[model samples]
Target: MSTARILIKHGDVRYRLLKVEAASDGSLICLLDKDPQPLKGGIRVETGKLIAEADLEKPVPYGRFSIHTTGEIHRYSGGQRKDTIHIEPLHQLTKAHAVGYFSIPTPERLDTYDASKHTADVVETLEIPTEVSERLTFLLEIGPKALKVATYGIGLSYELYTLVSRSAAARLPEELAASFVEAAALTVFDSRQIQKDEAELRFYQKIYGQGSFVFRENGGAYVALTSVPMARAPTMRVEFDGSELSIETIPFDAQNKPTHKVRFWIRDKGGRNKQHDLREHIRSVVFDARL
Candidate 1:
């Protein structure tokens, strides 16, 4: 049986797990280490109602869903609590999971981080410069917090919004909040140390369900890029000089999901580029990508 230890902390925050074990059967358990009982494992910061990411692979008719995680249990759907599109997709990738910010332990990400320090603090202690750290911190923490505030409405989640909002505006920077609302977001997870260019595909999720992408860059944990949604405008907009591409599409299926596609291309003499080169370009821009 294989065993691992996970340390979790954030600037003297409430939780710091000295040992979080991942059992062989995929069931997780808090181990005999660090802090005290009620250490709070499910502290998820849902910025707002989840606009389900479209699972085009298994598109369900509107007003109905069969969630795969829960034994394919079919559940009725309703109109969105917020003014955003409610597409039915599976899973969301937030900094909370990437950095273990009050989330259940997942062995894959934790094993790659510093085994002796909290995931968040290890990110902080990387000495990656204050401005960059602040940007990353906001991306993983306050930025997501702000997104929740922008799309809140009075429904079953009214109390939740009120509770999170009490400290949302006071604690978040106005500019970062505004940026998240007005753009498509990209999160790049670097895995060079593990000897791979693309570690895994993170489901790119955003408020409006605009397309998102993830890949690794050097010298950082991850990077994000956000752009305004233009699902059917037919404009060929490009960012990151030329490594990244996003364009509107005149397409719709049964669920009215935006059929936009993102393409990554790097310039070359043969009008083609290798995947490694593309990874390098994005990594070089991680610390300086437009948010």
Candidate 2:
């Protein structure tokens, strides 16, 4: 029930809605709406060896820009041959669905534009910067059940390259032309996917902060001190059995730094007290007279 519009423009050259048809694959087909006649041959671009004679200087008019509908090819008159343009069916149009370009050749001051004039409720027309211009082409993609929008760019590069290369390949069967064209187009899509994956991974890394810690806890209390500034470590605590005057020895080096040999003293003198270092280890420093 939803519909999308495709606009094509190149400088002063502009083409509006031409034709629309229901595709066999459940998607909609569109082209220059003027032409309703059957084409003599397949529609193609004017920038190839077949049209341009491989001559760089010749004007390769836009004849190949065609529309395929109703099992016929409808080509566009490059305006050089014909004043108006027509689109036919059965052109097997690819990457011909969505495209537009904007350019402004005059100074911003000369082009009277007001942001207040912009409104989604209506189709707003604004002049583009004269300094820039571009040509864009797109395709209508239908999934297993629905239609989707796709664009044409680098993929077209490989398509053009393959079309030109295979056309020039010596003694190549014409029947295989379709296969070469597909392969060339696919290679471009694959390369784009790889580049896209890399970009996505980079974005994910930024969102998910790094650095993780994994360790096990013992029954008794344990504490870990990290030398790294501002880093927090884990601490474990184990309670004494029954306020027993039990003592654990903790040894230390001459510099007073506790080593693994260091023992800790735990005495129930009202509350538990732990002193680390063998020198400070709980010993009978003052023998009890009763003992």
Model 1: pairs clashing at backbone N, Cα or C within 3 Å: 7-118, 47-148, 48-148, 53-89, 183-227, 184-226, 184-227, 186-224, 186-225, 217-283
State TM-scores per candidate.
0.20, 0.20
lDDT of 2 at 87: 21
* Stretches > 4 Å off in candidate 1: 1-228, 231-261, 274-291
Alpha-carbon deviation at 2 in model 2, angstroms? 11
TM-score of candidate 1 relative to the true fold: 0.20
Evaluated at residue 236, the lDDT of candidate 2 is 20
Clashing pairs counted in every model: 10, 28
Candidate 1 lDDT, 1-291, residue by residue in tens: 123332333333223222322221111222212322221111112463323333333322222111121011122222122111111121231222111111122211122333355432111111222232121211111112223433221111110111111111123333233211211122233211221111111123323244344333332122233333333422233344443422222343546432223233444445433334444334232111232
